[model samples]
Target chain A: MSYHTLQHLTVRLLFDEKFVKFVYEDPDSALLGLDLSKEEKAQLLAIDSRAWSYDSLRRLRTMRSLVEEFKASTTLVLAETRQLAFLDKFFSSPQFHDSIQKRGSMGLAFAEYLSEKFRQKELKTPQLADVLRLESLMARCRREFQKIRVTPLPKTLKDDLRIKFVPGADVGAFQANTVLTIQKIEKYLFEVNLMPAMVLCDDAPRLMDLPAVETKKKSYLMCVPAANGVSLIDIEKSDYLVLIEARSSLTIHQAIERAMASGITKSIAQEIIARALEEQTLHLV
Target chain B: MTKFFDKIAKIPRLGVGISGEFGSANKGIEACLLQENYPELVHFFEYGGDLDRGLDEHVRRWASTGLPTTYHFLDINIEERIDLTSDWLVETIEMAKEINATWLCGDAGRWHFGRRERGHQMLMPPILCMDSVLESVDNIRQIQEQSALCCLPENPPSVVYLGEMHILEYFAEIAERADCGILLDCAHLAIFQHSRNLAPLTGFDNFPFERVIEMHIAGGVLKETNGYQYIDDDHSPEPLESTWQILKYVIERAKNLRAIVYECEHNAAEECLDNFIKLNEMFPCKIETPKLTVK
Candidate 1:
């Protein structure tokens, strides 16, 4: 076969499954106008079996699975086939972006695909962007959790009680624009109990137990790492601000001074600092 | 440490294979990246899924750890796309540049290992002229030349239905014509023999060992399919006893080796690290001094 023709067939075989079918359906026409050997032609045609078709379909299916995992961690759980349908839209869309093969890029591809679907009015959902934005932030949070450095709290330093917040503490940086409430997501570990260090959340079933509040206002998320998954905890905005201020190394006296001066009574101010240390909102440097 | 493979003079760089321990390869990568000690070069599969936020976030982890990180990306689809080549170039090679990757590694064609031999056979693009061997070579050369990053194509695992072509002959001509090095996937070679229903290429003579700049060895399960037996590398199967033996054969012959990687993502972190240490012991970073200087 001429080099270019061989190259063309070879490339098509590696990329297009449809062409593979076309070749299989009409072997003579497929082999015509080309210079493949008897062996080469037979080999290409031999791929007409179930085993070969399954392999190609498996790879394409894997691309769908990749984004499917991202979707699982980001948005509300959907039926397996439902998620697959969403992915099918992207894979079948005119814009293929990259092969949604990589974990991070698959999410972007799905998000873009979802946005396009929303634009076309193909999807009947009004919260397309909201869902994508939420899932992307959770994915980001997971990445950030990996980067967190967990240091040992030196004994003498721990006794000092001046360092309130740990080195890798952040409250308002969840990266999601939507105000996620604890009531909405008892399962949302990405926001509620967010921290990297190993945490044993005692009978304290969740975040700073703000029971009286009906909705979590723009709150702080504490991502705490456990054995298998991350725990996202919700904290009051004021309390979160206090933890941020504690980054300046507020000693027990300074902390009480700041809390009291900010209009809290002496006893409440003392309890707040004690609570921060106990919960590891503050740790020894 | 001065040592001689067939042609190499320097000690080879080393890397660990990163695969998701739980379910996601990306998750395993996140955990691997957390290691205080990581190689300057890494081989990645499915590591580029999310660029703007997901993969980018993980890439940023390498920043404070050190400077100038180089990743060897294997997740990219390498088979030529007449029109898609340019966009693929932008997505992969450009992504490599953005991440400070030194070399982009990909299989020559048919990136995955399928149950059936013909799975990868369907990707041939239709063009009218040129030799297949040289055309494939040009495809690699064009990619290597176009990208700021160095591109190395690895050999695909062989199957019986495919047209007969020796891996060594294919790599030798491509290396010579494209001026490109090979990322020799030893597992693919092992499975190639198994899948092709042929005896092993026991003798190493005439093989283009010098063209191989890097090597990949992974643990695979012993498998039987269609009356043939081979080692399967997909699905992170546990390694068989002879896996290391096969690896030793290739490492000894790859004189120009710059990196010898142990694919351990499928195994436990401790087990993978232990395997990594064991391989390092066999092929130490500091090459043993030659017994006698050549006069």
Candidate 2:
């Protein structure tokens, strides 16, 4: 129990590069106020000076995983600026680091951090906020889907089958057309076959030549866990209403009725329900 | 001797180990399963998963085959009292039961600093002192009691170790106080000895070999940075000579040893076959026929 402080300090040494250097320079001064024992203090001082390089390697590993998790957002950030300044600022923030320590999804936490920056007008990129939001929702949906024991879909949506929105399925409204913007980003990434190594080395070709996206129209998209990855489906306000009603376990007929009560035409409600089942966004139980 | 000794003796030899996202990536056991001769090579799976991530489809598929499995956790910090929450224990036991795990095992190291998160995850060796050992003992005992399964504490790999006690002595004291089994990861021990400039078998003279229920053999890469040379546990097919030396020293001494896992999940089947043949030559399976097979 008493060694918790030692454990805490050691973790900081491994992760916080600045602190590692401070400790490496003057161990006694850096660890002055801690309640560690004399032997523990000696142990702390004995840490290899080369730990900074190890920590650098660890940070690279983290970046590699983050690239995989937030592909679209990372692609946009890199493509727009051709530099890692945005990422550097985000990774260095104490708030983001605290989120990582708290076991939060790195994608979701980064999305939240970017949203804050956008709110404060810190970000000038027109479509960056919407792109990050889209990726964050997809990441959340994927995580929620992973935690559930998914039941196999029936051959067809039967009248007797109970239907509900897949656990963690969510909808978002964005100022920019995220679906089209992501499609362009994916195509750009595919054409270049961007590798983390290239990005790390600053050898990646400048992508600033890409055309700016239109950011005036409001776009509605639903993110759901798909068979391979997350699926972002373009939808109308009517479809969103139907999906919201389907969140609770209900028969297809009941969902349609609720949608109709919400001012969605019965035929439109039926059509959206049928399409949701086909996309596997709404599951039969 | 405790009941865990007999329980672990039932585990088959020549198992395969995988951790992290190896299962999801279709590496580790998946690669081995693709081989036509895997039935002769792999007897059981040491399914290592983070409790937060749960098991993936590949692990579930392996479990569906009714193969023997042992759950190796990657999330818990057994040395930190705050990390041993009741909720964590419940979730861990649930995951172990889901895979029908034979027992539970993980490295007795600081898995994370404050909370068990992906960013904070690491494999630093415990501060090798009596207080750390006592704390770890209490935690291991709690895990064993809560899960009703034998808990084996593994010695974590580290480039730099701290404290007056040797790594072997630290784990030996925990095994005695907790009344549990031990998982002797030879590669990790090799790394520790090389870091301290000690012989491979320097500290084994007083170790509780009989308490060792499992042994791990993993490939490591030797690299030097800033005038410090250390073995990195990269899980390649070619294990260091020091690892093999440690394994050879303990093979006969570990009286209760039931498992010797080749942590070559990242290697291709052809690349691992040579080591598999070598391991089979050293410890032949007790059962004449393979217990698990892939279609």
Candidate 3:
């Protein structure tokens, strides 16, 4: 399979998006697509999800076991808890082990593993400085190892959407246009909407390490925070939109603080930006 | 082993403030230092989601001043963004050597599912298991763990696990098996309180109670969403009523508890720490200080 297809399949399976859409969008059509025998489909669909609540995974070894199970399944179906209880009904069923493994879903396994690690007691008390340093190192390692995709928005709509999450409200029409010249954009909307942002774009520049450009007009050097990477700087006043490619999304407050620290005048605080945008939209409409 | 919440409510001078990243707000620290009753310990918090700044700078700023302090490895944040492992251990110990730190506190291997997702749906670090904790504790326990620094044995320090209540029994069993100590945070226990009106630290009855070496106090409020609730939100300002109540209860019950550290953030953290100091003064023996020398 193509790597692209594999990634797409992974997302579809991880989130159950494709399966959910198929079930709700067209039950008969979905049933037709299932490779299982008619009896199997009936048995699978009739299973209750609440009957079998598997224990959560709180350790890496256990989580790894769960991951291995998921990777092995070809046509994995999340068996309902009752369906799990009915395993005896299909004693010779091929999906029995898979069903048991599915009981300890990825979420359950990962959350449990994290909980165990976070909760374990320490023998030797570490200095807070040392602990923080370890925490920083671990955090970097996690980010660097995890792979992800970055997608940009339509040029015209990116800024408008980004401004909506700025807390104060929307940005002015002029500020929204500033996104066009954006070499980097890091906004919270990208994460929430589940659509990759320009911050993940291949060509976006590092917002923090911009070259000094000689411009005729006074421009705003916007500092946008990249939660997983560097902060951004915008020097173009003509364009309202600036695009940022990111390794990951920034927390809501972190993004705002990053923007302010980037030299956004207090005059352009969230509220002011929203008000200006509203006035501009009114004039244009 | 003083119960952390009571100390926090009872003392007023023990409060300290924490910033997410080191040096993100030095100006704020300068302002804080201006206060007469400023706390001796200030935590510079950083995680994976934060900007990449070397820990050296934060350690330098804190160490440059000869004040006794702590630097918390808000490891959860770092776990979210890094490929953490034994290498991280070497670097952290080296950094500790450089700073001459008395103690180092970090997460066991837990992840906080906050407002956003960082692709953990794909890959996450190996969970910190009882065995993992014991192994790490044993590694740090070795005298050669840091041949460069001379830290005292009296304050041998502690390893803390910020996790569920029931898991305490398992942890205690592991600790007993390993002959190591633990730093118990009262607020975390309260967060794990279940439908049983039993105290959050009830599980400590199963552990080698004598091995508990430190306690943490903080104001924590239960947050409810979709009719479910949990504890350990650092953003909380004042210590919650339940948190303090649990602390007092733990103090009454536990025998091996030691130094109580008041953990909080912003102005509320200061206020909480102040209450902790007063508790220490009011009830000194209950919150015993371990006298270990660091060379």
Most DockQ-accurate candidate: 2
Measured over all alpha carbons after superposition, the RMSD of each candidate to the real structure, in angstroms, is 16.2, 7.5, 21.4
Model 3 alpha-carbon drift over 4 Å, by segment: A1-285, B1-21, B24-36, B39-52, B56-59, B76-84, B111-165, B195-198, B249-258, B268-274, B282-295
lDDT of 3 by residue, B1-295 (tens): 3232332233222222243344533423332342224433432222111112345364455556543343344333222222234444565566554555444444333332221223232221112234343443454344223433211111111111221224466446434543444555556556545322456556655555555544565666544433434343353556666666756765665564545555443343344555645545533532123467999
DockQ values of all predictions: 0.10, 0.20, 0.02
- Per-residue CA lDDT of candidate 3, range A1-285, in tens? 121122222222223333434544565774453344444344333423221111122223333443332221100111112122221222122232122222212323333332233245311111112222222323333333322222333323222233322211111121222332222222322242364465356654322322232233333433322444323344344223311111123332333455566665533444433443343211111
Return the TM-score for each candidate structure. Answer: 0.48, 0.70, 0.41
Best candidate (score: lDDT): 2
The candidates score, on chain A by TM-score, as follows 0.39, 0.66, 0.19
Show where candidate 1 strays beyond 4 Å: A1-36, A45-285, B1-26, B29-34, B37-54, B67-69, B74-94, B110-130, B146-149, B158-161, B222-231, B235-237, B286-295
Clashes of 2: 0
Estimate, for each residue in B1-295, the C-alpha lDDT of model 1 and write its tens digit: 2111322333234334343212344544353353435342333222322222224555555433333334444333343334224545566665666655546665665432221111122221122122445666767767776774455676655332254455555666666666677777777766665554544564346766776776667766665544445455663534445456666776787766666656565445555665656666655564233266689
lDDT of 2 by residue, A168-258 (tens): 6777777655667777777767756756456445556545544455556677788877766568777798888888777679998888888
The lDDT for every candidate, in the order shown, is 0.49, 0.75, 0.35
Worst 10 residues of 2 chain A by lDDT: A205-214
Interface RMSD, one decimal, each candidate = 10.4, 3.9, 15.6
Could you give candidate 2's per-residue lDDT for residues B75-170 as a string of tens digits?
888887778988679888998899898888888887765555445567778888898998899999999888989999999998767778999999
Clashing pairs in model 2? Answer: none
- Rate residue A253 of model 2 by lDDT: 84
Sort by TM-score, top down from the best: 2, 1, 3
